[model samples]
Target chain A: MSKLISCYRGAVDAWECDQMGHMNVQFYMAKGSEAFAHLQNALGLDPARIRKEKRGLRFKSLRTQYKSEVHAGSALHGIAGIRKLDGDVIHGFIQLFETAFDRLSAVYEFTALYTNLQTDEALPLPGDLRDRALALADDHPDIYQPAPFVGTVMPARPLKHMFESSRSSVDVWECDIFNHIEHRHIVGYFSDAATHIMGSVGLTRHTVRSRNLGSAALDYYSEFHAPIKMSTPVLLKSGLMGAKGKIFRFGHHLFDLDSGEIAISTTVLGCYFDMTARKSVPLPEEYANFPAEKVLAKQL
Target chain B: MSGYVESYRGQVLASECDLLGHMNIQFYISRLSQAIWNMCYFVGMAPEEIKGSKRALATVHQDSNYLSELMAGDIIHMETAVLKASTKTITFRHRLINSATGDPALTNISTVAYMDLTARKAIPLTEAMKIKVNELMVDAEDEA
Candidate 1:
């Protein structure tokens, strides 16, 4: 087992926390993305050299699982290691720890392609860079194990019904300099869809607040299929996957309205929370029958 | 896979790019989500209808693959096809193409379920809605 590279260290800021009183999903992704760049630098792919060579990395896929909640003012330490190196693609994982609690908060797994920026073609990792990457390769199996859903391939099945849950046109404020929506906003869309779904299930903010309970995502897996242009109108669809005990799973699809294509797919596992206790709680009686796979099949 | 129906289109703007000089991952997700709303409207499930009836769709799972890089000033064209449709759920596949190159840049698969807001439970698709879904359905094998 190689040593884990200490890639990033930071703190959870007040602004990063959401209504659930913990750092939001987007912030986690942002930090993880930053750590990815740091890992590249550690592997000798310095930004200046990359730019000079007209070379860059494109993220092909990402999967994240939240194991514990991090609150504002919590100290954060991100450790990363190369999981695999295949020609132009780098497969890696990052573990985020809340130093204050001495507990792991999240894990991020990603696949990125090293490419020639001008031609947009993949390039093999140079020998020296590969050596550096290898030095940082570590499999800390004892400290972290991926969630069961991390790489689960969703079954391909026919749709019985589809509903358009939300619609919004991209605005300048919503985009970054790359001429596309930022990673945070992509997760934000999923968050929005989840909120809407919860609302449909009588788990709205008001209801949750009144009941002193809320919902929190335990795991989030998303894929970026394509980039959405600025000023484009986008659509969102959401639905339930399953529910058991206090855990509820859901999915979302974002499409480019004009082209009629899917741009992203996300799966989220969430749990009911007792806000005061800052811990998970059982599903409410009213929501106990919330559609599970059996109910969904029956409806179909 | 048979063939996709045009779903959405738009131009990449300077602001959408990141410091890396390419479109960010989030924008792709946003655009595709907008297209889904349009599809619902096309199938007669307008936002107003959903709101009035207190019925909504919720996402259960989504998977996507980014095939190519897209930059500022590029025009994006997206197409969508129904992969599967059931009484309470629908699965869809979307492909995004760069107008300039006419090559696919991304593909995504998503599954969703219909729900009754008041009852807070999954609901069956109406016969009318099911017919529209069937009309848009395409076999994945056909795309090959």
Candidate 2:
């Protein structure tokens, strides 16, 4: 089926799988996010230029359906089409299919807000882009007809962990057609959680920023036990796992608290430093008050 | 055969890039693990063999160093050799090499514990299997 805009091929590499030997869940978001980038570039929305122009597009919301599993060494193709466009926001629908069988593996329907890049404030969609997007939607009605997976059941039991922090909704400027949370946003979540825990110990965001992100290496892997779409109000839990010398390990998990399912679990490794001189920093007195024993007991 | 047989090949696909167009770091680990699987299969510890023997290999620790950039559609090979084999665990070293030039691309060292597949508990490596794997051990000088 042809849309005004259409499918792009993706290959499943060995690295996309988990111990279960299938594509990890977060990758659906990752791949879908990749497709959106291609779509935007095709639509004349150069994110770099937008960033340079200080006029950005952010994802206000996203919704996704993972109907099947993609395995290592498989080929997948994503088909996409725009649905509607208001002045600044664009709504779109996309499908990821296994090229081997042409079976639908995942579907995403999302809304994104255009924003003033410089101010990080929402902006109205240009009339020309809106018309182009609507014109594209009309080409793929059969596929665009909404078959969304609303109200799906959450895991019967919540997969809660002590050391996870829930994420806050993007403040309007972070939304985009890409749909997946931006890398900075993911890092910001941990930073916020660190601040929260630090705040409990009497350290403030201002005091911490003086050190900057000296050196941080985040190793994150999230299995898509299920799909989480945009605007789902997902819960994130984060806590410090351990700190030795200047290195600290943080663990985070994202949950669909409503369904009690663990959507993703992540671990981040970081080192504290002056960042200005590129040297390690000593643990602050506030960090001395960290709840270590309580945190280690919950590690999975 | 004196030792186990191992074979590996790197993935070549364009979709592996992240938003930055570089191979995302996390997926790199997954690729390394798969290479280890291929090495295991070459050594006669195929999935069918493991299933029949009711034994499994579970990773305990992994250490890796990335030397250079690897891109999508680049053909590479991960050559694996058993570094050490003991009663309960086996240590392995894997080198990711360019398929065309045969140059080292990345290095990974991992330890895996043998386990009773059914009970999911660690088990001792049999003498015969140990000897077989030792034959496949890459000489120390050849490791680099």
Candidate 3:
């Protein structure tokens, strides 16, 4: 039998759709968060065990690729499997598919490490947990694996010229039982920050609407350096990484206000599309006109 | 017998849990609410048709038994089967199972009807719809 385990099944609700008429990126992350729970259970980290032990798997890094769009009322299901285990870190993948067409919708490639729920400290995987994960690890030659992310990836250190895109404090309702912010809400911050990032480059909401254009992230790569806890004031600094042809890359550095430490670094690759046609279009003139010295890609 | 098909499979979110430290009752109903659409699709009423014709299944009554508590980060899924189908209504059962323990978290019996949205009245099932729903019927004893 295939080592892949079924993880998520559900349909997209109308409210989950954005102006582009497809499920928003945040909701995609939400479904992925659900699938991640199942992945943990498969590794013997059931809810009861995690609650009793106060420890569980925390993401070290994750990459998501939006393959196809699913709209309101479209049914979706997901399957996940371990790709490999490297010492204390476990690498895995999850794919969500459109049930009706049996076509790929999104893919999540992630690496996680055992962590203390309260302290956000990385811990060595227990013997039993390690064995369970090692047993499930497979190089599944049949499954699809994304190629190495093209262009530059965000580094852990803060880069110059990045400007604040979002400022918010974590709310109790947005946290998991561990008091750490959940994955979906973390991505939601990125989603909301998109508008501000665009505004910094002269592509404000009014400008995009007037142009009848919408933006979509084709790929996103995020690296977690520290845990973002409840009620913590956080700020996201973003800068244009590069822009050419139909694609533009933006980079983000999420920092904790109290410690002033960069908590997460993310690189987003995306493009603008005609809202009516839903097809990719060339980057706006402003993208080409942005000062090259200010682009983070230059710093990288 | 292929009488029960997988309907809803997902995880329990922390926000869905109440002060009791378990998934709240409304979320259980919410999941079953989604399952109804899936179950309806298996019973010959596709979501597309429902959206296009403005004719869809609306649960008029349901009986629920919360067999176990599902905590945050727990994975669960539902296996649903048609219990009864008639000209005016369809009765189905969904057994929501905890994935790790393989135990039922909630068992829900829902009776829904195909209704005309504009008229707001229950409608009869066509002959084809009857055959599909009948194909999925399970004797009450068959339910686990």
Candidate 4:
């Protein structure tokens, strides 16, 4: 029998889409969050146990590749499985499909650790947990495995020219049952930071709209360094990674203000698309105007 | 054999829980309702086509078992398969499972009649619909 598990099945709600005419990147992270819960369950870390013990599998690193766009009213289903359980870290993946067209919409490849939910402390993998995960682990050669994140990846260091794109305290509602900020909210911060980054490049909603262009995230790689609990003061610093041809890349360092530590490091890649034509287009002329010395790729 | 195919996948929201601290009975049915639509599509009753033709599969009878309590944030999914089908009606069974525990939360069996929305009356199943029903049929004894 295949070790793979069908972990998610749901449709896109109309409200889940943003102005981009398709489901937003944050909503994809939301579904990935739900899928992660189930994957943890399969490893003997069910909800009741986690809520009682206050510990469960938490992602150390996650890479999301958006393959195709899904619109409102689209049905989505996902399958997840452990590729391997090595030492304290378990490698796994979740692939979400657009049911109507039977096409892969997005996939999340992740490395997780059983951790102290409150402290973000990695715990020793329990014997029973290791056994269960190993029993279900497989090569899963039939599934799609993306090439190691295509271009320059983000590092967890504060960059010299990185500017504050957003600063606020986490909200209670932005957390999951674990009381830690949900991955969707973290992605939300990055999504909103797009405006600030664009502003730095001398572009705005008016300028993009005048060109009938819409931006879409093509790939995202995030590394969680520490947990951001509810009400924690947070700050996001961002800098352009690179902008050339039709693609532009940006990097972020999300800081936990109280601890003065980088909570998460993320690299995002995306492109502008002609709204009416529904096709990717060249990076706006404005992107080239950003000071070359300010680009974070210099440090990377 | 087409034993069961997933019809629904989601999480329980905190608001959906009753004062008892588990998911409410109404929410179980609501998730089942979402499953029904997906099951219809599996049986070749594409929702868009049904919407255009003013035809739908309306449940005439149903029975369910709430075997386990579902807490908020619980990841859950449902799998369903056809039990039997006549010219005018099809009976199907859905098994809802808690993704974390791999325990059955609920099992719903529904008998639905093909209906004409405008006329508000049951209608006979089409040949293609019958073919899909047969393709999705599974043995009940083996399911349990």
TM-score of chain A of each: 0.84, 0.52, 0.98, 0.97
* Candidate 3: stretches off by over 4 Å: B50-55, B115-128, B141-144
For candidate 1 chain A, which ten residues in a row score worst on lDDT?
A: A150-159
- The DockQ assigned to candidate 1 is 0.04
What is the DockQ score, from 0 to 1, of model 2?
0.02
Reference-based lDDT, each prediction: 0.69, 0.57, 0.88, 0.87
List-wise, what DockQ does each model earn?
0.04, 0.02, 0.60, 0.34
Candidate 4: tens digits of C-alpha lDDT, residues A191-236: 8898898888889889989999999999999999888988999999
Cα lDDT of model 3 by residue, A175-199, tens digit: 9988989888888899988888888
By TM-score rank, best first, the candidates go 3, 4, 1, 2
What are the per-residue Cα lDDT tens digits for candidate 2 across A100-178? 4677887777667766644445767776556666666543546734453322122223333453455555432333323
Summing lDDT over every window of 10 consecutive residues in candidate 2 chain B, give the lowest-scoring window.
B1-10
Q: What is candidate 2's CA lDDT for residue B116?
A: 83
| Tens-digit lDDT track of model 1 for A217-239 | 88877666666767878988766
Superposed by TM-score, candidate 3 places the C-alpha of residue A16 at a distance from the truth, in angstroms, of 1.6
Indicate the docking level reached by candidate 1.
Answer: incorrect
> Quality of candidate 4's docking, in CAPRI categories?
acceptable
TM-score of each: 0.60, 0.40, 0.94, 0.84
Question: Each candidate's root-mean-square deviation in Å?
Answer: 22.4, 17.7, 2.0, 4.0
